[model samples]
Target: MKFTTVFVALVSAVPAVFGLTINTPANVVECQPILFSWSGGQSPYYLTLVPGGQSMASPIKSFPTQTGTSYTWNVDLQANTIFNIALKDSTGSTAYSDIVTIMSGSDTSCP
Candidate 1:
């Protein structure tokens, strides 16, 4: 019983694993100032817009490096488009958010 107690205590001491995270939904409005947020990984991260079915070598757009966790980004792309945010940290760690589709006007659904 003593051996079992020691094993349990050791396992609980492990730190929680938190990978790079971005909080944007799968769909957003076009031509609006959207709030973007992320966590984990190092600072001075860069962002790129990877269009759906396109190679990562050619991003549609690229943003400046960001050090803060959250920021407001203006979306000027066309509606009914698909894309993803490729986030790369200063240490070369990279992460990609789930695929996102753009919507126009007050309508937020895809057909």
Candidate 2:
């Protein structure tokens, strides 16, 4: 009976996902257009494209104080480069999006 009770409690425990999420694809091409979207964040939010494999420092590209859930961006980095997107909410909380890699323009798989 004790084992059954413990098993039921363990099975019922589930972690909730964080509210901030990145909606863009994992791959993109340089100098091409890409769309970004997210949900579960407060307005007056901000997102920035930062260099990969580094701490949150200077952002190569930044968006204005955004109130909507989506934004279109033109990537200007070279091919084969890695990057990260930083999202900040009105309360100054920040979250990092999935690491993205920029494909070569010649790569036909990029869209």
Candidate 3:
């Protein structure tokens, strides 16, 4: 009982210990270079696109990355779809960004 409580408490603090941030558009257009940025956490980091409006148990794409603050993601998908960024480090620590919607086409520019 006591061991279980302490283990649970420590596990819950992983996110706070390795903070991460995402700088990108929540709503994005497909087939474009969507720039992504982050801060904190150990490198080399891994990123994944988890499809929204469905189960998050799996990711659509995953890759290893460096500490670079920015990355370009070429969008290419159907409209009306949503997704969010999931970042992971070598130690199995993970972080998540806010959700974004993928559209067929849009005139909006990425930041």
For each candidate, give its TM-score against the true structure. Answer: 0.73, 0.71, 0.67
**Ranking of models by lDDT:** 1, 2, 3
Candidate 1: tens digits of C-alpha lDDT, residues 62-100: 888899987677777778778887888887777777778
Candidate numbers, best TM-score first, in rank order: 1, 2, 3
Q: What's the distance in Å from true for residue 69, model 1?
A: 0.9
Candidate 2 wrongly placed segments (more than 4 Å): 1-18, 106-111
Candidate 3 Cα deviation (angstroms), residue 47: 0.5
Candidate 1 local Cα displacement, residue 94, angstroms: 0.9
Looking at model 3, report the run of 10 residues with the lowest lDDT sum: 102-111
Candidate 3 structure quality by residue, lDDT tens digits, 58-84? 987665576675677777556666777
Best by TM-score: 1
lDDT of each: 0.75, 0.74, 0.71
lDDT of 2: 0.74
